[model samples]
Target: MYLIAGLQPPMDMRLFLHGFQDFFPSKAWQRTPVLYLPLVAFGRMTPMAWEELDQSLYTLHLPTPVTLRHTGFDVTLKRNRIILEATMEASVIDHLSVKIRNLAQRAGVSATRSLLPSGIPLADITDVDPSVCNLWLATHRHRFASTEEVCEFTVFKTGKNRENTFQEVMSDYQFADLFTPPSELL
Candidate 1:
């Protein structure tokens, strides 16, 4: 968690931050770790942009701000650009990221990285760009212990019961080898 205060920006920007803090107090913001999406956009932003994002997230049935353990978006407006910093769990990040990308696209902002949406075709797992493959592995890392487990899950998502070439897939994509943490850390 990081503070948004410095010399402060123009009056309108200050007002926007003030209003935002009024709703989602600074204490809560500082206590939690913030996860940032790979998207960046330039241009003036308003309270309406935040409201629209809130309304769109509401449609997704996510928990309210009172429960900050799950997910939320914090905007960091610098110069003439704004970055949507997301705080989320691995389980929901993929879904939220796709939605955020769509919203950014509508606003003419391009995402630096693209994530594979759930239910992607099995063939795409091998065909997608390497960066996309890495991002996919990253977003799913928390739920899986090893590449084999991820391969199993991916096959399951594709409506298949098994994958005989787990090694081949894992090697080709370089999801890399899993690391076993020190026992004390665990």
Candidate 2:
């Protein structure tokens, strides 16, 4: 199952912190693989006010980017939408669903305070063609020109299935420590 959320600007560290700070103690968790594309592509695909937010927000320094490793899950930014692509594993899908829901809830709270015009929603979950994931992996692999795109690319360590916690799922997928600060600014 794949879950997606359309987000516009003002989407800085605060928004993410609102959604996931409790679960992810550090900014490292935001380092999940991301693909950024024009906002128009997303607005054309969905009925969202993608153009309303300040475009400068996208330029803000986000957390470090994790290299694409052909992991079963991916988070893509097409215009304003954050597309979460994952395999059909129940635990994996469920964990991601909760994450998205948390984001939506937090976004809603912020919206009420007029932090932004509107909040992002957990748009939908659908069955995507396997080729979509394959294409993403292939494109990222080609773009980064890295042959060592495996799940264990990070340095974080974790135990296996300890109390069936979210950390356990992250550990199993080798995503326990997704963020790595770059030694030099590119």
Candidate 3:
């Protein structure tokens, strides 16, 4: 962070503190593999090189572009009725059913508030599709971008056979201390 901000710590003798836990299964020292490096690698002056031999059981790439089947959306304003819909190869309702009536209300449609549900009720959801996830988020976000400020919703299944979710990234960073690749990966 100091390097990114172009600032140095107050003194060279300063130190940082990380709590110690019994299950912290990472090493204090690890090789700086190109694949193991931090995300700032996006526009690095050089390219990366690697083999699965350096594969990490503990780490993963960030913002991995998970894919979903191609999808489409439906919209209508009939007989003064408003409708919105979408479908996809697979369904995960993380942001599937959002109501834009607030937009209608702002546009002078007062009755829209009572007609639209708090949000759409999703009929189906399966696994998390990274690509689908990205698309759904992008479209819906763009729709509400100007009308709503700071709006987002996320949903996982809430039925039988589900674990309580803290919704956090996994401990992949445990594979090493380095965030970027060694000269090899780069």
Q: Which candidate is the best by TM-score?
A: 1
- In terms of lDDT, the poorest run of 10 residues in model 1 is 149-158
Residues 29-82, candidate 2, lDDT per residue (tens digit)?
Answer: 332222211111111111132222222122223232222222233444434434
Please state every model's RMSD to the true fold in angstroms. 21.9, 18.9, 24.3
Write candidate 3's Cα lDDT for 1-186 as tens digits. 000000011111111101111212233211111110011100111111111111221122222221122233333332433322222232221221112222222333333212221222121222334455455446554221011111112111211211211122212222112243457876
Candidate 1 residues 1-186, lDDT tens each?
000100112234334333433443223232112111221121233445533533433333222111012133333433443222323234443544454446544644332233332221112122234464345346533431111111001000111211211211110111112353467986
Rate residue 130 of model 2 by lDDT.
44
Give the TM-score (vs. native) of candidate 3: 0.15
Cα-based lDDT at residue 30, candidate 3: 19
Candidate with the greatest lDDT versus the true structure: 1
